[model samples]
Target: MGMMKRLTAALAVATVLGGGLVAANAQEVVLRSADTHPDGYPTVEAVKFMSDVLKKETDGRISIQVFDSHQLGEEKETIEQTKFGVIDLNRVNFAPMNGIVPATIVPCMPYIFTSKENMRSVMDGPIGEDILKAFEPAGYVGLAVYDSGARSFYNSKHPIKTLEDLKGLKFRVIQSDLFVDMVNALGANATPMAYGEVYSGLQTGLIDGAENNWPSYESSKHFEVAKYYSLDQHSQCPEVLMMSKVSWDKLSPEDQTAVRDAAKQSVTKMRELWDAQEEKSRKIVEAAGVEINEVDPAPFVKAMDPIYEKYADTPELKDLVKRIRDTQK
Candidate 1:
């Protein structure tokens, strides 16, 4: 009878050990993330933060690998790959995705945001949530929004101090209807082009000017050719961190929670990096012999009023603009 009891006890111990081994094997997960920006940019910093947190939180069971500097592909291409489940995550500008998700274009409208603080408030609240929800149909899960900074004009021709100064200038703009329309309304010819082509376009004088935030302007060395830096702050364009719905839905509940938590933390870090870089960018461009001018934005604001009115008439987009304006402080 004692011999029989020993056999039973050994069987129970083996069962427990097997179950523990199965649980350990189930915890491992790997995810991939992509971005178009070069290393050392704010977006990369944020992605790195996410990668570090996910690994630490899951005790090495979850890991994220980031592809930077367009190593995977351009923003739009990367986002499309994410949708098709080829890539797990990407940081993309809202412009290209606007076609798939219409409301994404609203924030790119000129003069929509009065200040950086106002932009942050609206994006962190209901308006931001609504925009994020619009991504579901496109097979993307919008995780967080990172600052792209306020876009302004840069040209090699001449300084754009007044509305008339922009007349007939061929300015390269991203492929967005709102951006194209806004540039047209200001009396400049808007030539839609890819971000990678802008530097060479300016160098060859194929395009007389382009518009972007200070960090981009300085980092891409557009200031080298475009000696005129006009701080019109026309649009506050924020970059979005998104994940493939396929990959997101595949995560265990615990892993999903961890990913969300890491995303939130990364956004806070990205904003701090962006703010510091914007200030540093301004000094760098000024020292590079790039003429930095703070012009009156009233003219640009007045020019885009009609664009706002048109969007306001649309049922879905109307309330968001009102909410943003009301929340402005």
Candidate 2:
């Protein structure tokens, strides 16, 4: 009878508290995320950190399950899955996001950012926020951007000491028109190929060279066959973390805040991991006897003038590029 009386009293107190009523149990939410990179990649690590932070901030009410290495699907497939609400979150390259959110092209444009510091400054500021916000109309919410490092030219045949050396060399490039055009503008024959086939392509002498960041070159073991690495640092293609609008809308207001805050915190964690990974990869590649070279980027910059003229896709895009170029770190 005393227990019954206490239960009744507690019910009466809860009714009086109205919307402020406390419940003994809360709903649990599980979010599914996907990353194309392998485990231990900086982007994968960032997602893992985000998962931990979300669980902590939401008091275990929310948990994220991350699928890496195309376990769910390739980047483009996973993007569509996120949009359809099948995947709650995604880690993908920003270049493809331009197809859904055209404003992202500003960041994907070749040689736009003067350096990584310059790029991060723009990305971590209002401009980056604006770009992320642009995803809303496409049924996506951008959570954060991550480092992909600037891509540089590397090859097995010869060293690219000057602009002339780039001519007549067949190079493998990402299957993007911008990258293809950039390679052609640089006086090389651009052969579009899938990333997985690059090693065989280099090994079999199908292609003479490729362009990518240090971590990719080293991690992919492209440096083993391709001994010459020229640090032209041509493009700074960033990675993006995104959530489906459908999934986001399902989150409670408080949970929404928690997710956004967790994403913000994860960005800081990724920057550190990415920088350290790049340095470590560079050291490993150099110690492996990769002949690294630094070339004057002026000629390479001039080579892309035509590409810029062609890529100024809109007044908005042109203005965004101008803002990025004018931004000083």
List candidate 1 segments past 4 Å from native. 1-25, 194-197, 200-204, 309-313
Per-residue alpha-carbon lDDT of model 1 for 51-100, expressed as tens digits? 88988998888777777887766665666567756677889887777678
Give the winner by TM-score. Answer: 2
Tell me the tens digit of each residue's lDDT in model 2 across 30-88: 67788988888888888889889988887777877787988766777777767867678
TM-score per candidate, chains pooled: 0.85, 0.89
lDDT of 2: 0.84
Model 1 is weakest, by summed lDDT over 10 consecutive residues, at 14-23
- Kindly give the number of clashing pairs for every candidate: 0, 0
